[model samples]
Target: MAEEFRLRSVAVAVYGPAALFGLAEGAMLPVVALSAIDRGATTPVAALIGALLGIGALATNIPAGILATRVGERKSMLLAAAVSAVGLVLCLVNIGTGPGALVLYGAGVLLIGAASAVYSLARQSYLTESVPLHMRARALSTLGGTMRVGLFLGPFAGAAVMQFWGQSGAYYLSLAAVLAAGVVVYRVPDLETTAEHRAAAAAITTWGMIKRKWRVYATLGVGILLLSGIRQTRQTVVPLWAAHLGLSPTASSLIYGFAGAIDALVFYPAGKVMDRHGRRWVAVPSAFVLGASFVLMPLTHGAVLLAVVAMVMGFGNGVGSGIVMTLGADVSPAVGRPTHIGVWNELADVGSGLGPLLLAGVTALAGLGFGIVVSGLVGFAAAGALWTWIPRPSRGLRPAAVRGPPP
Candidate 1:
């Protein structure tokens, strides 16, 4: 009973901040391109500007890991929250439309992305050090689920505020959310760690740790890359296809919300499956279903049909919640775990950035539908990669070095 109580407390501490942070991100993300356009950027320039978020995150992942390793998770989180607040404040700046405005907004978005990398690494590190091996997947999945729930609700909240305050309202909402998250994190006590563990983690360089785990990175890392690519590509596929089918923006948003609702509902169950059966069970099915959905996406011509496909895509995504983080935790060493997770996150982010590029190139060569179909093929490849690479758990198999003590 005491163990359960501790687990619950940890959950409240970690997941609350995550949900709030996710809400801020969700509210802010949709307005990025629009904000750019409003600030005098061309359509293409606006798209590129919006992409700075991912670029900034990719650039900072390793550094975030290093920082977390040295300063501890709580401090890292606090620093990240401060940076995110600054970013939101920048977003709120209202200069007349020009290069000056664009530069400020772009810088803000970049800062938010960089801060997110730190916050995410810290949170994942915290959970990895707090939960026992048996409950790792469930805890991580619940973490993912809470973030998804926040994301689902955030846009509506943004819209509600937008009715009164316009695009700037979203930024205000995000700013408030991030600040609240920081407060929640501040109120929680840091996880207890031995001096030896801290010294050991601090001694190992991130590169050295990667060298030691090269095989794991080469094998499972590639699988994670492909999976992330497919998942990210799904975001583009739906809206692009909806536009192709002449669906209105309102219709597209509704379909997206419907799908997101489904996506947010399945994380806990997915985690349970991973804990009970294995990671492969959820990972394989998720990739397969997502692939199948993409393959069928081009065939849909109406809102109803597209909504149905979107729901399937959502379900596919929902089932794979926390799979990446759980896999990272499973493979990370107790020593320098933050750095290992940072590398893992970098790989996934690279894949995410690449997916849309691949889609764009393919579409330029062939057609939108063909490009989407190609992405679906990539999904199948992801499934195969995960199936081949993920370790098969046996009855005698013990958790890897990253697992913490029992609560």
Candidate 2:
């Protein structure tokens, strides 16, 4: 058996920037929507600006992967941070400038989204190459854990900055974080220059990689896509559900915050479980539990019950913290892993964008409760798909079923 992988300086180097980047992202996410509204956008338009973040990410996912191949992971990450910093500056400058301020804001948000896509794909690709199969789950999940911590901490930090300096201050905070992240990435060794990574980069074009692994991409990718959609829907519907309940804003924030903490706390254990048993062990339960939470959302009318459901959702989400990325790593050929990951991430981005839109449409036609139920249905459907599709690698040879390069 491969010796147990230990955390190394390199791993820390990769994760540090990701965590900082996520912190900046968390600070900006809430502020951007509010800023758009302040600049005179309608509620729907403001929401669209938020949605554009995911949409812009989706547009760039493929190219980002390819760029990593050409420029190397470290450089790609540095570029991403730099681009995001520029975007943040634009966001601050355009705030309340004029009638075109909202448009400028949307453009800035879109640039940040694209930069984020570049950073995520590059980092995930690096982890897949650097970590061994036996310990891939733990390593990647820890990556998720770091980001969750940032997400949990960022809002409070942003709120503190805004309290003194206003919305533009939050943007400035994000810019500072991104710049710091760039510095961290700059100091890391050029790990992506290893022969194996280089061969993988040269093995096939991104399009060629897709053609070779079309089946895995089509089947497992679709399942993960649904899971991604369900995940995003939970984020959206849960807040709406709280509003529907007429719960105090403070109470709602606390519930979500508590649930987020639950989600972050479980990531390490979830990774351990996946590594010890198999991906399905966590994947199946996560989908079912989260799906059940959505179904239970409308049935409960009180604050306590709503919180319970929310916690359940958090538990489900936590268990699958890095699952989608882990699964991508398992199936992708090491040599061309980055290219395949790009495709995988694109599906996830699609799902993220699709979920809110689906909920909005369903809620518009039916009711909010039913819209949530529809999300629940998607979750259950994803569970069924994952159970059938995730390959069962032999105990002696973890990740074995997915080892060979794509045809």
Candidate 3:
């Protein structure tokens, strides 16, 4: 356990830059939506900024998988970070009025998406190599937690720069963050690919490997789909819910940010439990906490009540969201890790993108409480599935299982 802790620490250090890049990846976009509107984009046009970013990410996923396989995950990641840095710099073009601004925004997002995909692949592959299978969950939890931390900080950083120096200042800060992250990555030691991995220069050409493992992936997809929906509801619908019950936007944002901060602090430790006790110990409790939070969130009308709900939600998110990434990394075949992880990340995003839409309908028809309860139920179901059939250490790699790496 001590040795595993040491190794996981090193892995976390390697991922430090990764966390910064991730912060920049998610932080600015939502705020950027506001910027776009200020720059004269219509509400639909402003919303399009976020939609375009998602679409761009979806488009690049396949290509990034191919690139990671051909170029090596390390190289792919470094390039991804560098390109993203450049894209962040391009945010200086705040299309204040015309379609030209929209075009530039689109281009910047496309580049950002391309870079993010490659960056994520490299980080996943790197952690896979650095951490033993037993400790991998904890390591990934730390990394994911960093990303959540970045979420906490990125908006503030962007907003601060914008407040003082304006939008140009914010973009410049974004560039600096990406560049700093890229520099750290470039300074790191090289990650070697296995011979089997080296020989494969293409994206997954044959479906056989993935098809055979369909059960695992399918189960994961369903489970995370639930998690993603929860995340979406929290992001898009929570504010409205708060308003219905009289919570301020500032208070709402704090609730959201606090959850992320708690996740950052708790994920690694929780992951250690996952490594030692078993996934169920973490997965089951995480779901219950999250589900209870959702069921109670709509009912809470005061700050004190909301704070309790947020803390519960954060702890549960740390377990489910952060832990899920680690498990996905574990299940993938080493040779196709980048591509496999890419698909997993994208599937997670499926819930992320669609979750808001589902919440919208729920809020429209049933009300905020209905949406919260349904979303929480989805999380509960996901946890239940993991508990019942996620192939405990009895079948997969855990203390009881042998030392062979996950395929």
Candidate 4:
């Protein structure tokens, strides 16, 4: 598997466009928040703009899976890019048009979210069929790492663009990057397909796939849901906790940025470990560490302790970069790969959407401290579930025709 993990031309072609699309998305994140604020939205309303991205993705996930089955990964990505370009244009056009601007901006961003779902699901499905089983983890993990790199760099680039041209100008960066990604998708040679792949895709309706994989979806998939939810909660709760402790916004932002750096640094190595060892090596520890971070949130008093905890949480998240997607790829049937992964991704979105809501509800009923603690407990429980539920690929499960596309 290690030997087979070499980066060939086709892999490069796929990854290249994906990285560009990620760069565009990363650059757009902060801009959307600021743009909404500038459009006369209150602070909470502006925050909702950021939240809409996830909401839109959640709404589109299942449908995107169906679209992928009909049109295939390459075409789906191309369509996504085109739609995203239109969304970016709308955001740019509505730039400072008063309170009504948010409506336009939100709509555009929502459309972009749908496009992202399609692009992501299609690419994941394509990789599942294109890469060998043994090398799959590394390839998918590398894919995750590449997007992180783009995300890391995107803000800096967007900030520079905003500095000169204002926040609205940042949309142009996204627009251009998206177009470039589209070009790559258009020019690159498509991965070869098989009759089984087509038949499986065609036969597997979204609802049918859900019914067929209900057991896995309900069990191991729940672990993934909790994992994703907990991960998102950390992002929201950490900042809220910082505010509760009277940490200045600047200090908190700096701490989070540093932690994100730590997360980005570990991607390739994490992939390597997952491949050589097994999923449990990273999965269980990540769950424990993340859960502990949340539980320990109230225990941190000063800035330094908070920073340390943030770094630990980042490390936990970093190591688990592609775990959800990798596990989804490992378990999905080759015939209806996109549908299975789509449902998996949709479950993930449910977790992500529910996380902040759960924290907010918990905080209102109890205290923020208790809410954090509850989240941590969920993480610990999820860790337990993942360890017990996720099946380990057999030592004898080497690359074979049985693992490949149907003849």
My TM-score estimates for the predictions, one after another, are: 0.96, 0.93, 0.89, 0.93
Candidate 2, residues 232-263: lDDT per residue as tens digits?
88888777998998988898998898889898
Sequence-dependent TM-score of model 1: 0.96
Q: Pick the candidate with the highest lDDT.
A: 1
Query: Per-residue CA lDDT of candidate 4, range 233-339, in tens?
Result: 88787788889999999998888887888878887788888888988888889888999988887999988999999999989888888888888886777577778
Question: What is the full ranking by lDDT, best candidate first?
Answer: 1, 2, 4, 3
Clashing pairs in 2: 200-335
Query: Over all chains combined, what TM-score does candidate 4 have?
Result: 0.93
lDDT of 4 at 106: 87
Error of 1 at 174 (Å): 0.4
Which tens-of-lDDT digit does each residue in 318-359 have in candidate 1? Answer: 999999999988888767889999999999999898888889
* Model 1 bad stretches (over 4 Å): 395-407
**Steric clash count of candidate 3:** 1
Order by TM-score, highest first: 1, 2, 4, 3
- Where in model 4 is the C-alpha error above 4 Å? 1-6, 95-100, 395-407
Off by over 4 Å in 3: 1-13, 194-196, 200-203, 398-407
lDDT per residue as tens, model 3, 1-407: 63554354454345678667766765576567776776678988888776766676666765676677778666777788788876776666764667787777667766887787677766766666666666767777777777777767877787777788866666777687787787776666665445664675364642644675678768866776666667656655456666776778888888767766776677777888878887778777886777777888877878777777887787777766466676676577756666776777777777777777776778789977897788777777867776765556666743222122222
After superposition on all CA atoms, what RMSD does each candidate show versus the true structure? 1.8, 3.5, 3.5, 2.7
